[model samples]
Target chain A: MAKPKIATTSLAGCFGCHMSLLDIDERILELVELVEFDKSPVDDIKNFTGRCAIGLVEGGCCNEHNVDVLREFRRHCDILISVGDCATMGGIPALRNTVPLRECLDEAFVNGPSVHNPDGKYPDDPEIPLILDKVYPAHEVVKIDYFLPGCPPTADTLWEALVALLNDKPVELPYQLVKYD
Target chain B: MSQSVMFMIDGVQVEGRAGQSILEAAGEAGVYIPRLCYKEGLSPHGSCRVCTVMVNGRPMSACTSPISLGMIVENDSPRVAQLRRDLIEMLFVAGNHFCMFCEKSGDCELQALAYRFGITAPKYPYMFPKREVDASHPDIFIDRNRCILCGRCVRASKELDGKNVFQFVGRSAEKRIAVNGEALADTDAAVTDAAADACPVGAILKKGVGYVVPVGKREYDDKPIGSDIEAKRPAAGS
Candidate 1:
């Protein structure tokens, strides 16, 4: 029988979670034997070729493209797990939640001291994804089946959750595996 | 010495002095009843409700509820555990608890309770309420965003420090900790006051001393909260 497929993505995150996934080290060999990659940066697959048994989502929805990608993952995967603080609770990027969207844009595009945009214009290219008013955790956008809470959940946490899910065991992580920072 | 009163907590017979709260009795008996507002040397405010336990089948804040003779109390039960978890979750969602960046991440009682309960993320939707951060004080800062409304600072200021430096303002959802004066700096709040150290969350912080304890070396980093209290328990066979 064909092994189950796992898809992963980094939306508005810093890609630290993806680095932590790679932090699993030699376990990647064991994981490759257990599951196939689909629609993930791991295999450089930009789109889903088939249904995935699990989708590991990193970061929260910070833009229209992030929501679209998250919704796509929800549509293509049977189980979706929020992989870190960003995906679970809109981590560092969500600091903008308290600030007005216009002010944030102005600071970045106009008011910032280091900004070189003498045109005093915001990025309005049609190709650029529109930013959302507020950063939203993955579960707020779609039904997240599981949440691994960490600032980029430790590599052991991701590995343990994956192994448990793959083995059809309950994903009850030990105390040490669950951390917010 | 006061007369001893007998009570049953989770099927274990425990003895306490008259007028002692269930939480105090449980502590003496080596049962760590989780609490946030009830601190040693301070009056129990019983606002946080993290220490809620079943008293005669009814839920009551163990910190404020005095134990009576022959009283049957339930601590560490599933129903009470779930209640505590829900309370902790509400506190998380109600506040902008960005633990990833919070200076009180490991040392915070709220964060440690969440860790003890193994809460990955709060089940409730984040309110993300707009709150203010008062950095006016040169020696200290008050980040109202992380305030859990536990009233520890309020009590500590009035009762311990005798300064009345903090008090609750507004009503219901608008309620928050307000300084005695316009800002914390305007008040007579000293960095060394007990109120400064009484906050269970990152709401109150001393300036120039943040992240001094590295991540791995911080309290509650490896051990669960209340482990120190639990350690007072007599060995199983002793």
Candidate 2:
């Protein structure tokens, strides 16, 4: 029988969670033997080829594209796990939640001291994804099966949760595995 | 000498003085009753409700309720645990608690409680209310975003420091911690005051010194909150 497939993505994140997942080191060999990668940066798969057993989302929804990608993952995967502080609680991106969108855009594109914009206009193009008014956690956008709360949710945390889910067991993380920072 | 009172906590008999609260007696008996507003050496405010325990099947704040003779207390029951978890979750969502970057992440009682409860993320939606950061004070800062309004500072300032430098302002959702004067800098708050050290979250922090303790060496990193109190328990089979 074919092994269960896992999908992963980084939305509005710094890709630290993916780095931590890779931090599993030689265990990656064991993981590949247990499950197949689908629609993940791990295999450079741009899109889903088939349904996934689990979806590991690494960030929150900060733009229309993020929402679209998260919704796509929700539809394609049987189980969705938020795999970091960013995916679970919006992380550093949500710091802009208090600031007005206009002010943030102006400060970034129009008035920042380091910015060099001759036209003094915000980035507006048909191809560019529109930014959302506020960043939202993955669960706020789509139903999340589980949440691994950490800055990058240590490699052990991701590995343990995936192993438990793959074996149809409960994902009961020990005290050391769960951390916010 | 005060008369000794015996009560049953989680069906285990425990003895305390007649005037002791359930929380105080529980602490002495080596049963860690989690609390925030009720700090040792300070008067119990009973405001946080994290220490709510079942007193003869009725919910009461263990920090404020005195233990009567033959009283039955339930501290670690599933129902009470869930209640505490709910309260912690509400506190998280109600405040803009960015735990990832909080200076008091490891040492914070609020964060430690959340960690102890295994709360990956709060179940409720984030309020994300716009709050202020008062950096006006040269020696200290008040980040309202992380404040849980537990009133620890209020009690500490008035009862311990005798400064009355902090107090609650507004009502209901608008409620927040306010300095005695127009700003914290205008007030007589000093970094050495017990009020400065009383905050359970990152709301109140001393300036110039942060992240001093490394990640692994910080308080509540290897052990859970209330471990110190639980460590005081008598050895089993004694």
Predicted structure with the largest DockQ when compared to the true one: 2
Where does model 1 exceed 4 Å of error?
A116-121, B236-238
Distance from true location, Cα of A96 in model 1, Å: 1.0
Candidate 2 residue-wise lDDT, A36-126, digit = tens:
9999999999999999999999999999999999999999999999999999989999999999999999999999999999999998997
DockQ of 1: 0.81
RMSD of 1: 1.5
- Model 1 Cα lDDT, one tens digit per residue, B1-238: 9999999999988899999999999998889999998889999999999999999999999999998999999998899999999999999989899998888888999999999998988889888889999999999999999998989999999999999999999988899999988899999999999999999999999999988999878898899998888888888767
Off by over 4 Å in 2: A116-120
User: Mind giving the per-residue lDDT tens digits that candidate 1 earns over A1-181?
Assistant: 9999999999989999999999999999999999999999889999999999999999999999999999999999999999999999999999999899999999999999899998999989999999999999999999999999898789999999999999999999988889898
CAPRI-style class, candidate 1: high
How many backbone clashes can be found in candidate 2? 0
**A4 Cα displacement, candidate 1 (Å):** 1.5
Question: DockQ (Cα-based) per candidate?
Answer: 0.81, 0.85
lDDT (C-alpha, whole model) for all candidates: 0.93, 0.94
Clashing pairs in 2: none
